[model samples]
Target chain A: MNEILTQSVFFGMFLTLACFEIGLWVKKKAKIAIANPLLVAVILIVAVLTLFHIDYENYKKGADYIQYFLTPATVSLAVPLYRQLSYLKKYPLAIIGGIAAGVLTAMGSIFLLSMAFGLNHEQYVTLLPKSITTAIGMGISDKMGGMAAITVIAISVTGITGTILAEAVCKLFGIREPVAKGLAIGTSAHALGTSKAMEIGEVEGAMSSLSIVVAGIMTVMSVPLFATLIQ
Target chain B: MKFLRQIAIIMGISFLAELLEALIPLPIAASMYGLVLMLLGLVTKLIPLEKVEGAADFLIEIMPLLFVPPTVSVIANLEALKSILVPLLVICISTTILIMAVTGRTAQSLMRIGRSGGEKQESRTVDCGKNKMKNKLATGEEEKTDE
Candidate 1:
């Protein structure tokens, strides 16, 4: 079974899709934030590989095919941003300022914490892009010589944290305005947070999706500047 | 055929962005360039929304699934990550909450300031009234849906 699976070039791709579908079903049934499809899929894939004693490299061989779409998908984020352009026009300062502040806070906090904890430069850079979408974050981390896998893990954790805490944080901060609520979630958590934002309201959903693009662009531009801090 | 064309356009832009990344001395990622280029194209009407909408939506839909492979690699590197796991968790959770608070407050205040400043103008009342009605309707529906 192991040999057959390893030899099949499409095994990893098939497994990923199948696991993700199961993840979708679980999310649909569970109706909870913790049941994030990506999180579920990751855990399921990890379990399957370990239980079957499949080598990571062999799985990665087929998995790389799916990973190839990541870049184009990142580029495709423009569509949603474009659709939400009206929100940008209506509250340019609020949206832009909110995302800018959030992006800065994300990077600043990571830098300070990394320093306080005595993390090395590579680890610092890896954590730098933790708050943005995984697609763009992975690219930034890779370009900066950080461990992309660690960066991916950090991004996922940040996203899940954002999704779970979104309501509590909003209430705690008294963020009544839909725009503010959306911006806060997207800036802090990326697309995962946007999922929760969509559930909250339409305007919040629009704003959250908008923030993903702006925050992504802002992070991509600013990561280099921040990366110089720890080095 | 239409979907294939849409994908071709996206890939073509990605290819161009890759070239730009290699040519430019800046540390910008190729994906950034592609995103900027795509946004610009859409804004300028160089690429109509119809042309890329289908493929773009499809791509975004499956985006999370694409990250599974890279994330799964974490298992192989668990040993190295163990030492810093506590700190990593601390930073991710703390900063996420902190960012949400800071961003929410900043935007809320700024929006309030804008509203107050605009409210004094008599000419804006009509627009404000319409907006208020819209908000009321939206919140009303939201409350109903909540139950």
Candidate 2:
């Protein structure tokens, strides 16, 4: 069993697909936001690997095939951004300013909080770019000598948490405008939260898509500067 | 065949972005360059939105699945993570709320300020309408379902 798990590429591929499908099924059955497919898949994969004592490196060989698509997937995001260009032109300053503010706040708060939390340099660096998309965030994290894998995990957790709480947060903050809601979600949670924002309405989807682009660029540009400041 | 071409175009743009990333001194990711380049292409009519919509839809729809492996790799750093998990969780959740509240409120205020002078923005609205129509004409069939 160990040999098959370690040596067979099909083993990892099958496990990942099966776990994701099962996660989808569970999400359908439970109908709860917390039963997110990504979250479910992560939990199941971690549990199974731990129980079987299968090494992460072995699992990653096949999984990396899926990971390879992340760059293309991220690039393709520009299509939606392009489609939403009209909205971008109409409210350029508001979107740019909001994303810039969110980026700065996200970086500042994470840097200070991580330091206060007594996390080491590696962990602090990992947590800094947690709000941006994986492709960009991973780049910044890697360049700064942070753990890319840890940044990936933190990014997912931050995305899921934001998606789950976005509506409540908006309501609590009295944020009624669709544009504002969308910007907030995308700026803070990146793609996953933007997916949720899409479900809310058309204007929200457009605004969220715009925020994803602006916030991604802002975070990529500013995270290094913030890193140097905090270090 | 059309979808394949669309994918090729997106990948080609990504390659250009990779090249730009290597050339640029800043820490900008190749994906950001790809995104900005794609936006430039669309704005300049170099690549119409129709050419990429199908491939883009497929890619974005499955993006969450792509991150699963990385998320699971968290198991490898369990010891380090376990100690910092609480603080990390606190920081993530609080910062998310803070970002959302701050950005949302700021955008709302800015939009209000814009709207105060936005009545004279008739030309921009018409410009957007013309662009939307052009986009609709380009992706007429898609507009039936997606718009």
Candidate 3:
């Protein structure tokens, strides 16, 4: 069985999609933020691989095809951002400043905490881009000599946390405005938080998507500068 | 055929962005370059929204699935993560809440300021109009005011 599965060109891809579909179904039935399809799929896939004692490399063979779409997906983010450009025009300063504040806070907090925790430079850099999307964050992590896989994990955890706590945080902070709410989520949690923002309202959804793009670009530009602080 | 063409355009931009990443001295990602290029094309009307909207939306919709493989690979690195797990969790959760609070407040306050400023300007204009109407009534130009 192992030999057959390993030799088949489509096995890994099949497993990935199948698991993801199951995850989607679970999320639909659960109706909860914590039941994130991506999270579910990751756990399912990891369990299957471990139980079967299949090598990670063999699974990666077909899974790499799915990963290939990441670039196009990242590029496609521009569509929503463009669609939300009207909001930018309406509250240009507020929107820009909100996202800027979020980005700065994300980097600054990580830097200070990592220093306090005595994290090495590489570890610190890996967490620097945690608040941004995986596609961009992974790139920043890899370029800065941090572990990309760890960065991916950190990003996923951060996103899930954002999704779960978005509303409570807003209420606590008195962030009543829809645009500000969206910016807060997107800046802190990336696309995953944007999903929660979309659930909140249309304006929030638009602003959240806009924040993903703006915050991503800002993080990419500023990460190099922040990386120098710990090193 | 249309979907195929749209994907081709997106892939073309991505490829160009890859080339730009190599040629440029900056540390920007190819994906970032692609995003900016796509936005510029759209904003300039060089690329019609309909040209890429369908494919782009489809791609974005399935984005979560794309990250599955990369994330699952984390299992292989669990050893390295074990030691720092506590600190990592602390930072991720704490900073997430902190960022949300800071960003939400900054945007909310700035928006309030912008709104108040706009309201003040609007009231000033209204006051000027009222003063003009009073002057016209005093001059027996009430007919113009009514018109």
Question: What DockQ does each prediction reach against the true complex?
Answer: 0.41, 0.34, 0.32
DockQ of 2: 0.34
lDDT of 3 by residue, A111-139 (tens): 99999999999889888998988867888
Candidate 1 lDDT over residue span B30-134, tens digit each: 776888899999999999999999998888777778777877888888986787788889999999999998888777656655655554232222223224543
Error of 2 at A136 (Å): 2.0
Candidate 2 residues A56-111, lDDT tens each? 87898788888777777777767767666677777777888888889889999998
- List, in the given order, the native-contact fraction of each candidate: 0.70, 0.70, 0.71
C-alpha RMSD over true interface residues, each candidate: 4.8, 6.4, 8.2
Q: How do all models score by TM-score?
A: 0.84, 0.87, 0.86
Cα misplacement distance, residue B121 of candidate 3 (Å) = 11
Comparing 2 with 3 on lDDT, the higher-scoring candidate is 3
Name the 10 consecutive residues with the lowest summed lDDT in model 1 chain A: A201-210
For model 1, which pairs clash? none
For model 1, residues A41-120, the per-residue Cα lDDT tens digits are 99999999999899888888899999888779878877877877776786788888888999999889899999999998
Q: Which ten residues in a row have the lowest lDDT in candidate 1 chain B?
A: B138-147
- lDDT tens digits, residues B10-38, model 2? 88998998999899976667877887888
Candidate 2, A79: how far from true, in Å? 1.4
| lDDT of all predictions | 0.82, 0.79, 0.82
TM-score for predicted model 2 compared with the true structure:
0.87
Q: What lDDT score goes with residue B23 in model 1?
A: 95
